[model samples]
Target: MIKHNIGLTSAEIGGLWEAFFQETMSVCLLKYFLHHIKDEEIKIVLTKALDFSHLNIKKIKEIYSKENIPLPDGFSEKDIDLSAPPLFNEPFALSYVYIMSRMGMINYAFITANIARSDILSFFTNALAQVTELYTDATTMMLSKGIYDRPPKISYPKKIEYIQKKSYISGFIGQKRTLNAVELTEIFFNIERNYFSILFCLGLIQVVKDKEIKNFIKDGKRISEKQINFFNEILQKEDFLGIISVSMEVTDSTISPFSDKLVMSLFHFLNSIDITLIGHALSMSMRADLSTFYSKVIGEILLYAESGFSIMVNRGWLEKPPQATNRKNLESR
Candidate 1:
């Protein structure tokens, strides 16, 4: 039903549709965070995030209106209770903002990279800037609050050197080479992200009341812990310290601050991103063992994603995405 001259492309529509739904969920979660957050500094960061989410939702609505497309029924105030007890402590909430902001930057960058339309491109560029600032502010706050776990410091190279041996990429035999900087960066980044996922899952498991969903989240936590230890063992083998855990940052809370749908959606999103990142790491990995391990882990995560989708579908929580017309059905008719 779109016009040829000025109508939005499918890519633009998909990007905006996904963004609108995510921003709506972000608004609801941030609103709850703002309500229960006691630290003024962290509160300020959450407020900024909430403001951006609200603005994105408004802009997306405008685009839909122009295109004569119906808006998605994303999360709203009805999906959250502001008066509920705090499910996550301030430090955990701060970490949540930091992690979510980082993901937001990745998403906006991806959307902007493929965009063609002038308005859509500009919208995502502005969104990228906002999320970058939000990430900066959240990380600064986490550091000031002493909740950030920085990567292990490596010594400066005595001098720039080029690869001189094939062993640099070998892993299936004798005299395997030590980890390179690129591989180490990817491993550490993965470990740190999975660490965050563990804590996030732990908090969610404690509060989510649905037995099935709670068990699914527990599987997520277990997977994260498994991955965390596997990656950490890699660094520890080199006598190098790894990023420590932040699971203790989560407080004991049985009350749910977010709806089950929001919690699962967040889990689904995080796991999906992890799959993408793991694929990148696998592609860059030179060691045969590491590459094989990443491939197996990816399969595991895909299964996990399938389970999450099932939960969402059974509960009638999953939103239907736009799809191409079924020409076969038309022909049969």
Candidate 2:
């Protein structure tokens, strides 16, 4: 979705808004996806939706450039607070997707209005229409799956006050809690499960294509194995399940709608995602259990993240963020 807030020019705020939305929404999208989706075909469709949103991040920047707007570095992927529990559970995932789709529509409509002179606006408008359809389909799918959760309605007049007071606590404090060994096991497997599920779907990203996704998945699958192994060791004697049996089970359809350059960019993005996943897993593991098991797991994931970082650099996809002030000097070499 696009933004229409009357604060700044497309150049000044476009990248920031895009980054802000994509970075935050992407994590939530991934979480709800892991909870609700099981079919490979369905996962593919969702992955395509994710690709659209991700690519729009770039398009927003390009649109800003076209409008002579100076895009601000508003935030990074870290801006999103995914550790907070989702607003709803699995039953609400589809509705959440729908809500996000509507948000995308609003965003794109605003972009179209602001940049009526740009060709990309036309493309975004087309995208907005399709996203509406995707939301419709996703909602229907959720209904068919018997898992659609709608926004809550007011049941009591005092509920507003209750929310005003407690929403802060619940949003910040109540959402995330340390899981027991059993809960911890579920959490790790759940992330692993979604990892492949999204990869299977990303095979359809029009810009990035399947081979890039497959290669990145190849690297990711091994890291996930390592992370699970580390966790299983942590859960020793607890009869906790780690990376037991899993499968991608993707269909044979292989066609890409994106350019190769974009595909490479996305693969790089996935690599960053892999490294971050390990960091989060390790961080949570440490917080939940200060035992040797957790420490060892962190060490293992640290190595894995470093390895992915090496690969990311080797692929020439290491995006020098703002902190890398000396990169210009290094690049000149």
Candidate 3:
């Protein structure tokens, strides 16, 4: 056991703080979903996800209690209403778990690499394994149910060749080359994520009670649409078919099943994910036009995320994360 005499390092503190908030939010969401989900396959996935989330929260609480750090006021029972009606259908729920599990895997991998505390690293390591299984199961179920959107297939290359010309990356002035498989894959996956975001915002906008929150959701939907158009147009120009909309998955339920705070928090999280995905796309995109477009899109998403954060702060809904001690101020005092 780690000595309680030694306090947590900054990296440990930050990682635990972030994990606490994220897992807490996941717990609330999973609980709500568990209440409404009827499909056996989907319910099983949700149950497992909820279990993992609770376990993570408990582990973090133990660490906090040992270290004498105040626990974060993450989402709790008040943040959700178990009696609320179902907001998403079975397929949507499964797809959500699949996508979130994928993101969770990425997060846990990062957390596992960034911290020094062996205990915290071990916790996240297990978390990653759990989510990896969840993703596998969810994807298998989705494919069986014919709900999974498989990426477009391309013809196999008969021969491999090296790029001998400097013009391969040029898209601004001369004949732009057809999108390679890597670029196409990135663009397609990015647009596919935006479609999910747009549908999520569309559904939430129909039920959110607060006008400010509603408008924010609307703004998010608009941005998703704009990004969708931007990326889809690129595919269109290349004569490649684009992804179909998942809006049909959302129902016409006008009842608010989630608290406005929960909804806003989800929006904030999604916007952050969007920025990350865009940055990844920007790095992988070789053509100048795609690179420039991804850069601009990232800027737009950053502005939107900032506005959402301001709203969260003004409403007293933002929970501050752990920070380093202000040594200079403490010394002056």
Candidate 4:
């Protein structure tokens, strides 16, 4: 039970870069293993992925050593059966990659900022650039083959600004004239994050494979579910306010941002979104006109954000950091 402290570390940032590769391999291999029955091309693809995973694993090990951080017992042959059929198929596999690459980019942007130390922060900046490049390459592959699931782009706005498809996702709220697109985005974004937390935690439990990883994932799942329901309750309270007439909706239909990595990517994206919403809450809280309940909910979300990051580490989705860096990040401001 890692006492899940707060804040960003260089190692964790690097670790996520490595984790993305690990997860990418996991999905690619899982899909090929299940469906490669007699297809030479799919087998070739699986072999190439296995090679990439092998190389990336070595690189990650080097990163851990460089940071003077111990690598947790990560995945191995014992955790999977090459002879066994894959639990996932092609459609889902592609979806997972597409969304997650976008999600990975978003998180790296945070890791770059959230990590204040020089060397550690540089590690993330470098990783972010590399991951961006990786994403671009993957996107090219998907585009060439016509398998990528692009994100929902908000079309260009005309009359009032750069608004696009957000209109469908948003609606007019009541009394408060200030509850425009930004406010509407906050509401639905918060709801989607809650939903993502629930689903990501659940998806993690399914393929954790290792004993420590599996138990950790299950524990995180429970925590995430509680937080999701908490957010849902808070949004319901917001409905009681005169801010807007539009009702909040948490649509469970998850969209694929990456070809196959939607689940993991959405999980990562939602975690980042929670942080953004917390910032919004804080800014709103400082206002003289904001309600007391909104401020309280902001306080609650702050703690829940800490918990969310903790669960990510516990599940091995987020890498643990070096003690020195960890201590500094957790220390009082």
Candidate 5:
């Protein structure tokens, strides 16, 4: 390990703190999956995933100890029940790991870019590399199994042509142009993500015991289904079929494998990711209709996320992050 005399900056602290919680939550979920997974190949992959989460937690704890920062009380064994019946089938477990690894890569890259300290930077850089390898492994396994949902293919243009008319960007008015490659790619990716979100919500909804929490998850499922239909309709209008994974399956198990706190926290984490992706899609989209749709759904998602936050706060489950000192109160004293 590289030794650094310099203390961590706010960005480094924030990133590490958030990562601690994320990895701990992942450890709980991955352990449950490992207990139920039967496929030897997938079992190996999940074991690797569990090991990575444990390693991350260990490193973060060391850093916190060196800095004299109290460790966050992240998810623990109490939050998960290993003996509960399997909530998802084998294929869905593999797919979940694949998608989560992709998300992890994005998150690690962002954190790595923001940190200046050499030690913290090295940690995130190594994390990015590990998650990238995991992503590749999952993807290769999916492809070999013929379960990968490939994006739609477009014919190669014979000649390079620039947009000569303003109508090329317009979609709500007369003579709307067919979806461009970039636009189609965003739509397809969003649809793919929502499909997974629907499955996740479906599995959780069946086992969640709290009435309010169950209703919240049910609302999330409905939103995902609506968004999928919206994106699919856009593709259908252009004579392109939407991509859906046939391997995604949720079991009929009603046994709760996770605490209500963990479930709510997971939903909040995923909602933040969904909002970020939709904002990126909005930036890439040029058509009025697509842009309008993204903007509207962002508001809807934000509202749902806020409701979840309120629920967590009311139940005293939301952990507050470190904040600046209250100078005003000190001055008054």
Candidate 6:
């Protein structure tokens, strides 16, 4: 093990802090899924995911103890109901793991890159590898089950070509050029994620009793639908079919399987991810129309996320992460 005498940097603390909550939340979700899951293949994958989450939580706690940092009170057994009937079908559970593993891979890789402390770096490096394997596992299972939604395929170019006309980038007026491969890939992934988001909101809205929370989730579902229509319309104009995952489906169970706080926090997390993804799509888009669309939707998502954040704060659900000491306040005192 590499030893570091220096303390954790703010970035490292922030990364670990975020990871702790994420993993704890995962533990609750995976346990609930395990209770209702019948498919052995998907069960095995979820079990592995739960084990990884447990290991991550354990490691994070160790690091926190060594640093004399207080542990975060993330989601736990109280947040989930194992006795409640399945709120989502088996296929949806598998798809959830697949999508979440992909997100975990992205997050772990990003955190690992930003970490400088050797021990923390090693921890996240291992985490990235574990989540990558989980992603591969979930993907393989989806492919074998014929549930994986493949992106649209385009004909290969005959020769290396360069854009010579300014109209190539022009999308606001005249005939807009078809989406490039990069842009198509981004839009395709975003649509898949939004589909999951819609299903998530639909499931929660069915069981959550709080009127305000239910309305918030209803709005989230509507926003996802609008975003999906926008992306699908763009694809339709190009004669390419819009991507939709047929494997995902929510059950009619009205029993609340999770606390309102957990559901709201999960929604906030997903919305934040959506904003990050849309921002990236905006940067990669060369066409003004695509960029403009992404920017517009990003603003909508930010507003929705902010509302959810306020709810979490008001309900005492949001955990405060490590922060710099208030030196100015010390002088004032």
| lDDT of candidate 6 over 136-226, digit per residue (tens) | 9999999999989888898898899998888887854668888899998998898898898888888888899999899999999999899
Q: What TM-score, computed on C-alpha atoms, does each candidate reach?
A: 0.94, 0.39, 0.94, 0.45, 0.96, 0.97
Task: Supply the global lDDT for candidate 5.
Answer: 0.89
Each model's lDDT comes to 0.84, 0.48, 0.82, 0.47, 0.89, 0.89
Model 6 lDDT vs. the true structure? 0.89
**What's the lDDT for residue 135 in model 1?**
92
| Best-to-worst TM-score order | 6, 5, 3, 1, 4, 2
TM-score of predicted model 4? Answer: 0.45
Stretches > 4 Å off in candidate 3: 1-6, 172-174, 246-248
Per-prediction count of colliding residue pairs? 0, 11, 0, 24, 0, 0
Number of the top lDDT candidate: 5
Q: Write the per-residue lDDT of candidate 5 for residues 71-162, one digit (tens) a residue.
A: 99989999999989999989887887898898888888888999999889989998898899889989999988887887889998899899
Distance (Å) between predicted and true CA of 70, model 4?
A: 4.7
* lDDT head-to-head 4 vs 5, winner: 5
The 10-residue segment with the lowest total lDDT in model 6: 166-175
Per-residue lDDT of candidate 3, residues 125-186 (tens digit): 88889999999999899888887777777889999899887778884475798888888888
Candidate with more favorable, higher lDDT: 2 or 5: 5
Model 6 clash number:
0
RMSD of each: 2.5, 13.3, 2.0, 11.5, 1.9, 1.6
Candidate 5: list runs displaced more than 4 Å: 1-4
Residue 223 in model 1: shift from native, Å?
0.6
Which whole-number lDDT from 0 to 100 does residue 295 have in model 5? Answer: 95
Question: What tens digits encode model 2's per-residue C-alpha lDDT throughout 129-186?
Answer: 8678767877688667755433212223443333244333223443423334434643
